[model samples]
Target chain A: MNRRCSLITILATAAALFTGCEREEIRVYSVAKETAEAPAKAASDTPTPAANAPRPQLAYTLPAGWQDAGPTPMSLANFRITTDAGEASVNITPLASMAGKEALVVNMWREQVGQKPLAEGELAGALAPIEIGGEKGQLFEIAGSRDGQTVRIITAFLHRGGASWFYKLQGADAVLTAQKPVFVEFLKTVRIKEPGSAPAAEVVKVADPAPAATAEFKWKVPEGWQTLPAGQMQVAKFAVPARDGAKAEVFVSVFPSDTGGALANVNRWRRQLGLEAVDEAGLKALVTPLEGAPGAMLVDLKSDAKAMLGAIVPREGRWWFYKLMGDTAAVTAERAAFIRFVQTAP
Target chain B: MKLLWKFFTSLRLTVWTLGFAIALVFLGTLAQVHEGLWDGQTRWFRSYFVLRKAGDVWWVPPVFPGGYFIGAVLLLNLLAAHLKRFQLTWRKAGINLTHFGILLMLVGGLATDMYSRESVMNLREGGTRFFSEATREHELVFIRTLDDAREEVVAIPTALLRTGAEVRDAKLPFPVKVKSYWVNSTPDFRAPMGKNAAPLSDKGIAKDWDFSERPETKGMDDRNLPTAILDLGEHGVWVVPSWASDELLIESVKRTYTKSVGAETAAGMAAKMAAPQEVEAGGRKWRMTLRPTRHYNSFSLTLLKTTHEIYLGTSTSTNPQGIPKNFQSRVRINNPTKGETREVDIYMNNPLRYEGLTFFQATMGRDEIVDVGRSGLQVVRNPSWLVPYLSCLLVGIGLTVQFLYHLIGFITKRRATVAV
Candidate 1:
């Protein structure tokens, strides 16, 4: 190839890269956030109470033959009732807000039972007003077939304290129909108490799922520590080089909250080491606050042959656990370094 | 110049480049087991050099020539050899055409890799959407609500959202200080605050939930939920996680609106306004969210219906769930600018191509809790989609012509020998 031709080929290749590559750029645009006009108008017309109104304590009386199944992760209150027809379940869940998309929620239940989503125009007629906690609430009843069986779902929701509470009763069609009257009566019995007031039945507080946020944790690793693949529930793992024919492993793990608290975790580690579990007073004497790391507690537990040096630190609504476990000699050798590692971590 | 020309046209160089390509493919395929398909393809095939990450550190160094390097060398070698043996005669036509075809394919592949983008659009029955979301990319967007139901949005791509970086733009009122960014995360609802549990944020669901980073999942069905913390200075630090719904934050912000209402009528009006979370900055109400990167189009698609078929007699005593046979989504396309309106069905093996975009029915399911049929459409845009077909056609034609030329010459030689 001539020199000119070769130059052209090189230029063409470079040009291809520039032409094909999609540049990542900041975009500014004006877009219509909402597409449906009907739903937005309907939401505006819906009666919403004052947002700053004092939130009332909610308590409910259970219907006869209904067993309290206790609160679940998703539901604040759960109850079960069984009959010859089929078992029915009742649960109360709270959503911060639905943003006036109650029709969407109702349509979700409809689709669950193999029914189509309800149109916005038909949403008002589909919902029946009922009393809940002495306030007006809307009730939706949907019936459909699922897996060749007729199923029914009855959901009643009320807005309070800038949130929506949904009380849903779902079961087979025949069972739900039989319990419809009883369900209404149960709804009528729901009463609001003054702030911090206790009633005959206490509403169970359910834990909301907290998404784990990543925060940078910085610590200097001691020399001779070989990095190992972290196992499930662990953030980091390292193997200390063998010394005196004994080896120790370092594990760093974190949890959303204090995993069973410091005493329980310490006792569990003690049990693993075949040592007697200690009480709160014993735990207080055993664990010392890690130096330079505020709110971090360090504990040293040693058995006849096995030993564990652990630290528990709480930060940002999460608990960080660092442990050095293995042979007694190895754990003792690594204890100082392990304490330093935990102290330097954020 | 002569030495370089000889080197470029060397058969030895061509053989080595081809050998490296084979090795690149083999190694890249194997690397997918550890790095995943997307990451492996990017590192081994798209890049010019194969880079190896240092143990437990961010340092990565090039270890060997990657696919792009080998491809470029092979392209140059072919061009040199073709030019060196160039002839206008019909006998050389087949060889020249084959070389040109390969060159076209190489260029096309590079073009496709750079320009083509894949995204997904999820629509419920009777739902309409004008934008598709990228599967892997994410963006932090600040939106200001305007009159007439419109919103002015300023989006920052994930590449610019590094931890500790203060991102500033002309459109932004305040510099956004990124505290942390998690590539993949999980929510722990059982956040029991310890005695020294310092609050991460005063706004949003982060006040109640704790988030932690997890290893990125490679499964096709799984997606990484990224979380970020932004220090908005006087506006307060906010923890943002990629939640399916933004109602929690919207409600939290609205709760503050209730306190501002002085009159009874104003309180009633404020109560009815279920507005999004808005921060007052630069005399504008800004709402921020970390969400999937979106590619908006002028046209819109509304899902009319979704049909999920199951194999007959698949549900038995042993198998409670029936086997899925096929899924189809009926969608209506509406483009006001072009004045185009049409309805089409997208199903397995049958994709709908409209206006340079192809939509394939990827998955179909119903949300049990929400009672809505969902259809996931895989949207792909490739300008060079036809290049591979044309390249293969040219090669096939060239090979056939070359075979015919030799076959005719052999037949003629046999005839002349018989005549002698």
Candidate 2:
């Protein structure tokens, strides 16, 4: 009996230990929130420039035969010169605090043109000295082959006011060579001015020009709705007065393309109301055709406390999004009016 | 029963187990060339069987007894042998001590393997962290900010996350249903999305980007970027990827609104916008992220400074930037329970061991543009770290006692002969 009891105890203990070896369960815990801390003062001996220093403006004369290509994502000012040989482009870009990494910057341009990167020791030997805006700078002329054709690049960079400005002209060898002298003369005409200075004619301002709306659609404003100025990316805006301390707004926005499709747009509206997103099939089930508008679908999403009423209308190669978002009660009150308002012609 | 006892207590079992151990080590080392150290160790040493995939299929069969099997056998063999031959005598004391020491070591090894934890803490200068994250494993976390200083977090381990798995907890307002789980995925920002693009998550950053599945990374320096499409019944489907940078994504969205509203209002509305990896339900905001599994601690470490130094004027042909000679982190430890707030410096060789954990300086990097320095510390917790030392001491004492006893007996016998 004793031996049998001992065996049973051993097996039971073994089973208990094995059972305890299962994977950990889901855990819930409260932790102190992470608060951002200010970075410690830099220990370097040299004074580091502040990132948000006062802005400076650059004014330059546009060379003849060169047309302003407008601003690009990579450059603040862009100009193009077209000839029989090929088109050459000039770009002026400003970067903050490139003080000690000049060689790194030059190497990046070299790599762009299929040229080998130069070491910091070899940088000075490869670059020639030039003057830009009365300030000394380095000019790099690199010629490399791309797609069995010779490509030439002429770039000059200067450091001033804790910012590095690069003026680069690149194109087919023949075109770039022809425009090189003109680019150099244009660089000499560049001048940096402090902010709040009087503007010169043809001087490009340093600001992102908001895209002009291609087309406008008239909407029948409901009673008790207040008119407000449209914000960026919005064509028109209307505010609904606060009811029970809850405010709602209607925004009419247009995008160049289908902004990630109708499903994405409906989900974006749904997400605003703390509601779960639905798939394409689910979206179709929830979408209702606008009464007077053809090929337009309206979505109404409501959560416990919040709601959003939106419409996706496609017209004239653009997508129009109409959204009315606010407290659930307010949205519920305006659901019919919101749908009727979206049914207006584009 | 008698035959079983004989077999377990036999010396032949010991020899065979040791031979298998040597073979296991050899195979594991060779596997590391392709499988990496961590994975190889897990496959060969941490398991009981060496499993082989049955010809490119999911079926894996045990082909050989692995390290754990051999170790357990050897342990049982030693224990049984000691039990069978146990005798309390001065003459046999040394042998018994030596056997017990080896037994203790084997048990300690198993303990360490089962209980040890390795994690990492990354902190920028003046940043404080109360938890260390697992080096490789990931967890899905839903964090609700209760206030400016406190947050309620519910974390689900990735092991429990599988396709078609619905995870529910009392603390969760809704069930987290996983639609698809990718162990490794790469995001493409420029991929054109047509009407027929794969149906990804309906919300979050994944809607703006396309993700492609990739093979799991096995390199020592590489990590798998996991992505999961999760559905919360009525709340919405969200794509949570490990590679999403919440700060950068939120800042970009805030910048768009800041152009219209003032900077202050935009900053306040950052969480209000459809921020990536964020969801809202029950009038509460929850930020979801698939990140390295975190191990919270009772105390916190605040990074005060990071010092990186290199030998002056020393540059090699391969390294234009001089090789780092030293990396140090100055950290302040805060333990509210003990009312202890003290600063300590951890460097390459010197580590800070406190509260059953050891913090070693692992890596340091600096962002020259932002002038922010970050430090990574390897946190290791092993309760049996001193077991090897204690075992070695016992073995030394046992062998010394054995050798001295024989020497004394031999000398005394010789002296007796000389006197006679």
Candidate 3:
């Protein structure tokens, strides 16, 4: 009886030890279903009246020969300025109630230029006081080399209207140096339009610009091709007829030559046609000279069902593209004609 | 039999095992710089024998005894010593209790190592979450949305994503075949006309970018993002790692669909808008995307606000360096099944222990552009989490009582000797 009782006790203890802790059951719910069923309750209850308030207007004048790229997600305003050397970009961003400080911002920009962050005492020497929008602002110019290429940056910071507005222009050293005066002039025109205030008549209206003159490039159209008016960022557009009744498109556009370099652009075009990208040697072998335009390169690639013909023309620090893409058969037949059109483009 | 009993209750064995444990901890701490925290723990603490790579070679040879081995030996020694040498008396009760507590701790540690789960829940300001994602594991989730406002989910853990393996479930309409899997990969863009290019597997964004195998990350802050290329027989899909932001997934879907549908015309491609991908599977329309593996909970938490404050002078020129002083999250927990709702403030060192889980403030940051705060809460569920606390208390009481008893006995003996 004693042995049996001891055995029973051991077994009971083992059972209790193993069964002491229980695993909790996991419950799964459809968040999407719940949200769709009760949108009002499912949404956050935090009141954000300030989020719905009307934003203050920011006004600025465009420098001569500068084109506006409109607003981007991170920038309040973006402009592309073309110079003889290259194209430079000017971006204005307003950070409202940001936790960031001036020293941090300056140091971040310094790091971008491959320079060490300045000490507190060195900041005063690095920054120059400038007048912007009738307010005192700080301007900084930094020049450095990135990947064997000389790059320059001009940055300005203005504290006004409960926000820190940053204006930065970056490009090749030569082009940035040339556009420094224009950037300074542009900064002087910055103004903050108060809420519910109308702009004075003398102020340049933010409305769309008047229709511009026709683009300078001209080319002969092939037979059965329809010429369409060019849209934003395009010099010309043509609809070419494909044998399969599907319409192919041809576009003529120009951008800064430093935009991702020639190899990257070629690879981008190749990716669109479902072709594999090539190395620099392969790209050089594939590129043929344009007959009419000297120093211009043409690339013709054909895939299973699609084909792309493009010409990269270098002129005055700008790279012009004359591209035609369509069904394989159509593009093959029109290859010579597209090349001729690109050769004739001036 | 006498010799074997003596060996089992030997204090020498305890000392040796403890020495091995100390060596294991020191080596494990050094290994963390190269192997990362999770790998180090698995290699040293969780295994029976700690192994070290034979000089840069792939072979791992046993170098030292591991935590489990030492712990098991120590537990046996304690039990044997107590059963054979300890006397059952009021004076010895404290010693017995202390030994018992240590034994409980050893067993509890083993159980916790096997059963504990850790995950992280990220919440933006005003965001709600009912699930937390696993930190070190990946899962392929197949969700079927029913018409009755319900969902049936099938999650396949990363262990099953082997090449040529077919995973099937009773509720799944078809089996999924794993074509390829990579624990760590670097994204490589293919050259359009380059020779010896990798073949495109699926008709998705992966065709444009190839993932090449890479060495695993080795740090506490970095993690390996496993990528898998799965074949659904007629259809194929590439599963890539998801970032904290869902916008990347949406943008990838948009770009992939635009290219696939022959919408690569400059105009059409430029006008593409972000959208989620939905596919009809198992007679139900399901939204499909590769996301972090989630552990669903019975309760839901909504973050009302998150605040991160830096030291007052850190923003000035005097300091010029931002040092975070405090990070906090105001959250409301709702358990619909239990009909319990409560608001809790979780901050550093002050975690909320509810429903057998502990939520601790792990990370906090602010989105500069959007001016919104984000918070990361680490959720830990360990059944034996209280074992160490109980052990410490028991040991403290036991030592105090034993010390007092010894003192009293010494004084009484001295007085008796003087009187004699």
Candidate 4:
């Protein structure tokens, strides 16, 4: 069991960590203070740029055959924007569907980052998006190094009415790390469209289970004993008639089959009481009720194993048992009366 | 003088100290009903506090028995009494063994305090490790030098610096101050943030104050508290943000007028306006960055992989989540001193210790868009932590032996009765 438990834990961890194979923080720490976007080039070394680079051209090549997935999200939708050394991407997820900055969102990110949730006084950063790659997107930036690296995440959100998209980019600020451009390229593929405007996914319907055709009826039994119908969790009951307002109840789990039936049952009851515990052979040698009116057998036993006796009736497959147990003297006096009651349990 | 031993080792003293210790813990637990170990806990208990108003105000963690303090006292008493009483017994060997165990525990605690490098090692999937870093323990302090009084005078509210702004605290004579801070400061990098109010440059200070005046304190960036914005020219802008202005804080040439926590304008789901900001004094500050420390060179670690485990078949309605198991972050360690780099695996409860520092696996996070992983670790540098481990082992062994002795005695008595 312990091994199985550990196996499950290992599987769960693997499933969680393997989501996106081994993620690492890429950070480049420099003493220089300015966020100074590295000079667009090593040269023009002297030539100062004219106000802005000619209409901000896309410096990196787009992946071949990469088509737009959707359009920018509608305004008022929660969005995120990420800017890296290369390009940038944006994602928008509808606040309505996601339940708006819910606890799950943080948890999901925590998992992605291979971290637990933020401890108290640890979540220190900014909200709202700044423009990345000339496109406006929500930007969530955290400026603290965790472990031994500085991790900054900028999330841009774009929300349409019912749905939303989010673009998240995080990594160590490295002068040279692989994630920088990959993140930017990842953002380029994201686009949103009108819901349902796209072809609807095929829907499959499943048939519902047939309802139970249950019927209710009333029956009178020995005074102080109650008869529960078949539909109730309690199938049938036969009480040892009330004496001075105090009664002991015997419950029965009834079935309709008799194969490997009643003979197997009487001994099962005796075995349960742990009072010398008889076997089917011993049961045959003892009690007298089996000339085939559904094979009945009875043996005197203690009340301590009552639950076990009640359990046996459910067994015997379809063979129902009219088992009764109570204060010995009380039961002995009422035995014949209870036996007649079981015959009508239906 | 003999009475002194009675005083220190007196039963009355022991009982009083013991009772007080026990009471202290209970009261501390109760006080936690009002205040807790952290401001978040304190804030969490705030509304539910059925206690008095002054409860939180005068809150201090209870100094009860730990494996160290009370353990020491108990051991000292045991040692003295045993030496005097059992010195004549042939069972002195047994008693010696017991006392040795206890002494070991006390010595162990001291060793732990001095030498033990107990730290947490948290690693997700693929995380790196550095040899000189240990996982465990943290400090809350602002870096600063002593003031004119020759005493450690790093005053707060000044300890609270606004983002992109330096913290300014005042001293009666000459104010001692430290600049630059971060809320969730890491081993590297700090993001700049400030209040919604105007920059401190608009309020006071010299216009030419030059420095990366951001994140100079723990959670000290962008004035979340309210304040009189000091527009000190180049000194940058500073606004005492937050709702409350406990007092006018003047440190050095920087003067920031702060108020109490005022409004709730966060994203509603925000826990509260802010955490509890206390007016503290005498707190020490040492730069504890993952970068090049005052002595050690800046080394880097790479995340190999971070793996996690969870308890099975149970969700929120069923079972509580289990601890992360086998948190192994394979790290490539680089030593600037030796000019050598080594790769080692770091996991929970296990760390890579070298030089004076130790590193433990702490936590892990992912960068989905960035395509990478991040792992947190606790770094420590205590020199003598093993003594406690040895002492504890001895003590535990002695206790087990003693308990079994009595247990066997009982069993023999029962057997004798049956035979009779």
C-alpha local distance difference test of each model: 0.73, 0.74, 0.67, 0.39
TM-score of each: 0.57, 0.57, 0.54, 0.34
User: For model 1, what is the error of residue A221's alpha carbon versus the real structure, in angstroms, after optimal superposition?
Assistant: 60
Poorest lDDT segment (10 consecutive residues) of candidate 3 chain B:
B265-274
- Over the stretch A1-346, how does candidate 2's per-residue lDDT look in tens digits? 2434434443453344334344767989999876555554221211222213344556775654567776632246777676666777787766544667767777765665578999778988888888897788879887776545666778888887756788888776877865777788778878877567775335622122122332344657899899787654466788886778787888887665665688877887777776788998998899988766668888878787778888988876666788998887777777787777877764
Cα lDDT for residue B86, model 4? 47
Give me the TM-scores of chain B across the candidates: 0.87, 0.88, 0.85, 0.49
Stretch of 10 with least lDDT, candidate 1 chain B: B188-197
- Would you list the rank order by lDDT, best first? 2, 1, 3, 4
Question: Which DockQ-derived CAPRI band holds candidate 3?
Answer: incorrect
Q: Give per-residue CA lDDT, model 2, range B209-252, as digits (tens).
A: 55667988877788887888889989888888776533434456
Residue-level lDDT of model 1, residues B196-249, one tens digit each, is: 134567565554455678887765557777878898888888777764223333
Off by over 4 Å in 3: A1-346, B1-7, B54-61, B188-199, B207-209, B237-281, B286-288, B317-321
Q: Give each candidate's interface RMSD in Å.
A: 12.2, 10.8, 13.0, 24.1
Ranked by DockQ from best down, the candidates are: 1, 2, 3, 4
* lDDT, residue B231, model 2: 92
Backbone collisions counted per model: 13, 4, 7, 126
The residue pairs in collision within model 3 are: A276-B191, A276-B192, A276-B193, A277-B191, A277-B192, A277-B193, A278-B192
Predicted model 3 interface RMSD: 13.0
Query: lDDT tens digits, residues B1-420, model 4?
Result: 456445444666557656755754565455544343433222222222233334344554322333234434554555445534445443344446666876676555444444444443333234322323221112122233354323232223322333344433343222222233333221100111110122224321211111222332212112222223333333333322222111111110111101110111111101111112222334532211111111123565555655555555443654455544455667776666678788787777788776656777766655321345556666676665665566667667667766776777799999999999
